[model samples]
Target: WHWPTAWCHMFLAPLFAATGLLLRLLLRLLLDLHALFFLPHREAEGFKEQGNAFYIKKDYEEAFNYYTKAIDMCPKNASYYGNRAATLMMLYRYREALEDAQQSVRLDNSFMKGHLREGKCHLSLGNAMAARRCFQKVLELEPDNGQAQQELKNAEAILEYERMAEIGFEKRDFRMVSFPFLRCVMRPLTAASFRQISAPLSGFLLSSPRSDILRMDSTNADALYVRGLCLYYEDCIDKAVQFFVQALRMAPDHDKARLACRNAKALKAKKEEGNKAFKEGSYEAAYELYSEALTIDPNNIKTNAKLYCNRATVGSKLKKLDQAIEDCSKAIKLDETYIKAYLRRAQCYMDTEQYEEAVRDYEKVYQTEKTKEHKHLLKNAQLELKKSKRKDYYKVLGVDKNATEEEIKKAYRKRALLHHPDRHSSATPEVQKEEEKKFKEVGEAFSVLSDPKKKSRYDSGQDLEDDGMNMGDFDANNIFKAFFGGPGGFSFEASGPGNFFFQFG
Candidate 1:
């Protein structure tokens, strides 16, 4: 059956093509089977389990190694990459963590934790905008995720803060003049007009508008003065002083620049002395130095604000709480966006038992920073405020929230003796009545706080008035007798409310 040459050639080509296709398919099957047998899924899973164990133990380095091994065995596994990303994040390797987190999300787009890790990496790297997007993606994946919600809020706050900071800077700088004429004419004229009319000029081509003017006309005294003002406001003291000096050199008769330069130098020196004294625990010296700095540069709002804040800190150390609060307020007035001043004022408020003011300041701080510590402080202030609205057992007894049972007992014993009605017998009727009221309050406080269930209920914000814990029903005299075995057991010498001496029989 010999066919024609052309037909035979056609048949052989088809047969060869089919055979090659079958061979390739068979080779791929063999490779897959080899992978299944040699690269055991169980082994990879074991490595992942080991990684998890190390992670639980907080041994991030060991966990990273095991996760890497697991990834090597199962390159397509999103979970392995996610786990490694978490380990890297614990090590503060945000860039590496970001890469792994991205890879994990690429492998499994639906992986919520992968997106969460990616968001956290973005946040740690200070890319709040990117972090916001990642957190939004996580919310899309898992709508009820609490961590994602909080992180999204944090990212939004940071972005808002940064936006406000930029606006503030623009407002302070003359470069952002919005008038069409000034925007178009004054800006270009300041930078390029001198260059065009005068000889070719050259200096450091800096990134600021004033710096541009300086680059064209380095000897321009007014531009130098303005540049120095920018640095001075930015809190770059030494650089600002240098620019001011340069301006004075360019025009010795420039009184404004001369005054600024002198004030900058004096302020810097005084601020340094204040800081040194503060670090050495000399609160009075620090206060004096900071005050001097404030006086040296009353016109320098930014620097004066910082000096006020520094003095506030010294005042706090000296237990001059009112002065500290006033100083913080002055700082806040000078720079409304001053976070440190707000925080300092909040602490002073807490120290002075102004719980409501403290809560407000802490809330502001939390809104800006949104850190765990800030949240904690805000919560504590709120709790104190709540307690203040009711009978503040801790405040009445002069005890802390974490006071031990023995400490509570000691505080109760001391308070009972001080507020005892008999102790104020020689005082006026108004004083006696006030002492009586305080005595009753002390008894009610002890009644609630001495009982574990009552204390817990009070601390958790439960209404104790409905829980058979009425102050009217509480007997101050009976409680005092029970605690101190009556006046016969303990003799007290008292001239007034604060002066009491007890001698136990």
Candidate 2:
């Protein structure tokens, strides 16, 4: 053991060190764990890279396929799930994306990207409450998450709007409600509420995203006409008119727009005619023209009210007392504070001998009016009320209070002949009825004055109660008997062949 060869052998290294390293390498190859651990992961990363490229290019279909394959290869990978959910969200497949994002979160509870994607999916699906919860959770996990905070604020705003809408609908307070939901869905860029509070916001939504009016192309006329129709429904009458005019300028043969233009033109002409009539003091003509205009445009409030006011004035002037009252009532129904209608109707009632009704209308005008003209009219009405009184029916019949019996008979005969129903065949039914009534009153006056007993009773201011005298009671035979000696004065005899004589002596 103490020899030189033994000392040299003791100082020499092991010959199998290289063999051990080689053996370890062979063992790694046999187990196939190195390729299994790294190569598949590397392939997944390459696929993810390609997917990202395609997604950035907006080739969502290809990106979706590539991401799906990557996710299949790496089933437990949170990043792959997040990418796929994003692509699905872009494709508007929100429900499926929500499931994928939720699975990603389950796989890795600390994944902020997964929470954001899920929240976006919920938002897209109109689940704002759920989206808000998810976004809040993301902010809780990562306090510096600006995107999550912004999204949470948006969700809260949406929730607040929905709550307001619910309260408004419950209380029937539509003016307090905003149409945020419709705006979100339709996404109109330049919207007008169009003075119609209940109108849906989709009415203002343009098919194109741009605000500039489209130029007239070969198809522009058709598009313009369609847009005009939409604008008309949206209550943008001026814009609709412009669109229709443009359409007509481009294609004069467009039947739809031509009809619309013609209707609008006719309506405008009728309105102008009404205004002209009103200015010229032709109230009846103005009412007719306004009514015609309303026939063309039923929703025209100005025309409706103008027609009501003008007709009310016309009815008053024409002495159509009830009609004037109804017209003013309708005018006030259309616009509750129509001072002119109230004033005009008050005057009409005064003319019609309805003092109390006139006073009420005047009071309504006084309550609604702030003008000096109305104040003056109300003062005039009060003065008129003091002077108003019931008219005498006997004076209206144009007969004296103590006319002789022959004079009364002659006057009654003349009046009955003048106002007979047969003389008024072409008159209105109401006029004919009135004439017949006057004729009957004249006959009654003659009958009462002709009878001495009735004349005595009527002269003493006693009410001559009707005893239902028949025509037979006042017949010529009875009058002859009374006038010619009361049942002892008449004789009839056959004097000769075909001849007879009657005598009263």
Candidate 3:
């Protein structure tokens, strides 16, 4: 064992070196295990906190970098992916944010913030339907989430606006289609005070879900303009004008604010002129002025609705019955509760002898107003409609309603003789048929009018005793025979009218 001391020294030195290398490898593996099991978790948590701090400071790029680092350290952590997604959204990388959000939800389907971020991305990218589903999913996870409720309302309002606009386009109704986006964009912020007006304007305020940009930076021109829109739609025209002017001052190139301001001013001026003209009884001038006002801003739904109604009134005065009806209908479409429009349309329908349409409009007016005048109009329309349905027996017989019995018999006899079918038997079939029809009408008129009971009933607007009565009930031949003495007693010359003398058959 102790042979050759130099060889023993060489072997011992090599064995010690190998043992040292093995010990070093074991220590390195232990360090790697520590970094894997403990250090990464701590580092990832620290990175996530840093990312949140940058996010709170609104430093989106730095936030994005930190969140990405956290994700790199903890790739399967749903919260890291969600945080990264939110930072990506703040950076305006919606597509990338959407991917991260989706991944976060896939990693942990119950992550409400991940779903919220995904919904936000979808909304920003104009996928309202998809955004709605995401918000709905969030609500399913946390039913009382106020943010998700508001966002869900926003998506639903957008979809409803689109549906209404499509219906208006299909019906060729401009009132229903105009201002839909404006209304839809205003929904979530003013749902209680202004129930009828809503909007889906997700980015109009240019703010993230966590904080309002306008609150942070009041000089944002676009935000100011959107506020102006809200005021303008709420009928606060002066305040809206002020905001619009402020926006224009902040951003000199703000074309929409300038146009809105101009339109608001012009609308007020033209509407006032229209009112002046109407008060002065200058209906033609009023109609022109109101029409001009309507063309100024189609997005001003309330003002345009009023303008349409005013124009309808002027149209009524100018005897433009059809145009008046159309204008009133437009006003009603713009504002379904517009009682004045219904009244105007009813009057136009009355003038046009459209009693059924008049009745419908008057009924709506009466239902909404419940006023004595509206009720009277509704009743009058119903009466006129009832009378219109019945044949004017006196008119058909060429006699006045007050014609005496003798006068009625005389008129009927003359009309019957003139339109007798046999007298025109040699004429064309069409002419013969027409003569026969008139002959039957004359006889029926006599049958109804010559009888005192029937005449009284007819004059009183009561239905005849026989509801199924027709020309057959009148028996023109029998009436002719009875009037001329007997069935075979009288005949007429068929050749010409002047040679018609009764002869015994």
How close is each model in CA RMSD to the real structure? 25.0, 33.5, 25.9
| TM-score, candidate number 3 | 0.47
After TM-score superposition, what is the CA distance of residue 164 in candidate 3 from its true location, in Å? 25
lDDT accuracy of residue 429 in candidate 1: 100
For model 3, the local distance difference test gives 0.79
Candidate 3 Cα outliers beyond 4 Å, as residue runs: 1-231, 234-261, 279-282, 394-418, 428-433, 446-456, 466-472, 475-505
Lowest summed lDDT across 10 adjacent residues in model 3 is found at 189-198
Report the error of model 1 at residue 409, Å. 4.8
- Residues 32-80, model 2: lDDT tens digits: 9767877778888889999999999999989999898898778899989
Question: Number of backbone collisions per candidate, in order?
Answer: 0, 0, 10
* Per-residue lDDT value at 456 in model 1: 93
Best-first order by TM-score: 1, 3, 2
Reference-based TM-score of each model: 0.49, 0.35, 0.47
In candidate 3, what are the lDDT values of residues 23-121, reduced to their tens digit?
999999999999887799899999999999999999989999998898898899999999989888766557789999999999999999999999988
**Residue pairs with backbone overlap in model 2:** none
Error of 2 at 488 (Å): 99
Q: Name the 10 consecutive residues with the lowest summed lDDT in model 1.
A: 194-203
* Backbone clash pairs in model 1 (N, Cα, C under 3 Å; residues 3+ apart or in different chains), count: 0
Per lDDT, what order, best first? Answer: 3, 1, 2
